[model samples]
Target: MFETELTRTLNIRHPIFQAPMAGGPTTPDLVAAVSNAGGIGNLGAGYLTPEQLRGAIQKIRELTDQPFGVNLFVPEQPEVSEQTEEAVAQMTEYLNKYRDKLGIVQNPSIKKFSESFEEQVQVLLEEKIPVFSFTFGIPSLDVIHAMQQQGTVVIGTATTVEEANHLEAAGVNAIVAQGCEAGGHRGTFLKSVSESLIGTMALVPQIVDHVSVPVIASGGIMDGRGLVASLALGAAAVQMGTAFLACPESGAHETYKQKILASNEDSTEITLAYSGKAARGIRTAFMNDMQQYPGEIPAYPIQNALTRDIRQAAAKANDSQYMSLWAGQGVRLANDQSAAAIVKQTIDQAYTLVQNRFR
Candidate 1:
C-alpha cells in the first residue's frame, strides 16, 4: 500500500513533493500549480518578510484549495568579526561594476536581515497552515512543539544520515534526504558542507535506515527512474527541485530556465559563492570570480545581502553569468512544460515502472 500517513497528512494524490526552492524560483503560481496537480507544492518563504509571506500564502489560497507547505530558512546569529568586514569589502569591487552599469555611485548598504522566524511562525500559526518545512537548520524544540500543537505537519531537510537522525530527534514528522545532486542550498546541519556531500544513490537509503520518521528523498530525482529508485530505497515519497524549475509557473527567469534545459549531468558544481553556504548550480562567471577570491566571502545573509543588487540587475538584464542560476545535477532532465503536466507525467511514468517491475 502507499505510505498512509504521508498521503493522509499532505492530502496529495501522488507521493511527490515539489521542493521549496528559495531565492527567486518558488512562486505562488508554481506552488498552486503543483498542489492543483495532486502533489504538495511549497512556497520558499525563507527570504520574504512576514507580510510578504502572508501575502504569498493568501495568493496560493486564492488559486487552489489543496494543502500546501511553506519552507523557511532558519537563521543563526553569526559572530561578525574584522574578517567579516574585510570579506564584505572584497565584494565592493564587484558591486562597483554593477553600480556603474545601473548608474549608481555606490552599492546599496547591507540591509538588516528582514526575515523573522518568530514573526513568521506566528503568522503560520494564525493562518493554521497545513505544512511547514525548514532548511539551513532545524527549529528550536519550543518552536517545533508550537507548530506541532497547531497541527502543522513539519518536514526537516537533511544532507546526511546524521542530519536525518537529528531531525527525527527534533520531532519532525518527516525527513527530506537532500542528496548532493540536489539544487539550491546543502542542508548539512552542523557538519561542514564539504563533508556531507553524499550523492542521491548513496545517501537516500542510509538516511531511510537511520531515521525513525518517514524519509522523503530529494536531489537529482527528475524522472520515473529516479522516483522508482527513491521508493526502492525506503523513501515514503520523492521531492524534486530542478525538474520543476523549467515549468512555466516557476519564478525562474527565462535565462535560468534556458540554462537548465541546455545543461548536462556535468554542467553543475558545488560552490559557496552565491549565498556563503555551499549549493550546487551551473558554473558561471560569478562563480569563477568567487573561486578566484576564495576565503574572502562573508557569512551568509551578509554575502547574500551584498550580492542582492547585482543578482537583481542580472535577472533584469537576463545575464546568466551574474545570476545565481540555482539548480541540481539533474538539470538536463528539466522539461519545459506546465507544472501540472510535468507532475502528472513524472508520477504516471513512475507508477508504470513500479507496476511493470512486479509483473
Candidate 2:
C-alpha cells in the first residue's frame, strides 16, 4: 500500500518523511530510527559547518543502512541597504540586554552571515547522499546536475506555486509544498510573505495541478488522518515536524518536548523576532516583547545568527520563554512515543484508512 511513486523513487517503504527539524531536534538516533521504520529520515544540516555536516552524515550512515536524507538552508547572500542597517542596529541593541542577562562579560560581535554553501554541497556530492533537499532558495542547475549525475535525488522547498515552477524548471526531483502552518522558517523567497501564506490543503493541490514533479505536502500534518487527507489532496507524501518533536529519539530540549506535549492549537504563533524570519513557534515572552521591532529586524541568516546565543543559554537554563520553540499548528496532537512507533502508527493507520475507504 505504501508503494507510491515517492516511496519507490526514494526506495523507502513508506511515504512519511520526518521533517528535518533544524538545530537541536534531528539527532542521529531520531533520523536513523525513522528510516529504520521504513520511512524517510532527515538530518537538519542547515546550520552545520562543512565538517560538522560531514560528521553528522557519517553518524547517520553508521546508525542505519536504510535510506535517509539531509536538508540544507540555502545561504542568503547579505545585501547592504538602509533597512539592513537600521535592523542590525536595533537587533544588536535588543540582543545586548540578553547578553547582559546571560552574564557574558564582553559583547562578542555576532558571527558574520556568509556561509560556505558550496563547501556543503561538495560534501553532499562526495558523501553521495541518497536524497539531498534544500530550503530557503533553489540551488543552481549545475549544482543540481552534478548531484543528479551521481544518482542523488535533489528536492527543493516551495511556499508558492511560482517557487514550485522555478524549482521544477531548475530540475528538482520533487517539491515540498510548505504551507503557512508549517513550523520553523517559511521557505518564501520570491513573493512578499503575505502573498505566500497559503494553507496546506489549498497549497498542495494547486502545486500538484501545476507541476509535473511529485509534490510532498508539509505543514500542520500530524497523524494518520492528516496523512490520508494530504494524499487525497494529491500529495505524494507528508513531511511532518511538530509531531516528531515529541518523539523520544529527538534531540530537542526536555523542556521543548514537554511544551510540545502540553501545547494546544492556539499556543503556537508566527513571529519574526526569533530569527528575523516569519517562523511559527511556541509564543514566548521574547516573541511578544520583540513583536514591536519588526521594522528593526534584519533578514534571515543574520537574524537567525543573532538569536543563537540567547536560545542556547535559555535552553541550558531551562528558560523556555526565550528559546526558539519552533512548532507546527497541530502541536496539540503530539504524543510521547519513539520515532519508530510514530512512523509505524502513522503509516499503519493511514494505510488502513485508505484501504477501508476503497473496500
lDDT of each: 0.85, 0.88
Tell me the tens digit of each residue's lDDT in model 1 across 69-169: 99998887564567677767777666676667655557577657446788888888888888999998988999889889988999999988888888899
Q: What are the TM-scores, per candidate, against the unseen true structure?
A: 0.95, 0.96
Expressed as tens digits, the lDDT of each residue in 177-207 for candidate 2 is 9999999989998998889999999999999
Shift in Å, residue 3, candidate 2? 1.6
What local lDDT does model 1 show for residue 197? 90
- The clash count of every prediction, one per candidate, is 0, 0
- In Å, residue 132's CA in model 1 sits off its true spot by 0.3
- Model 2 residue 244 CA deviation in Å: 0.7
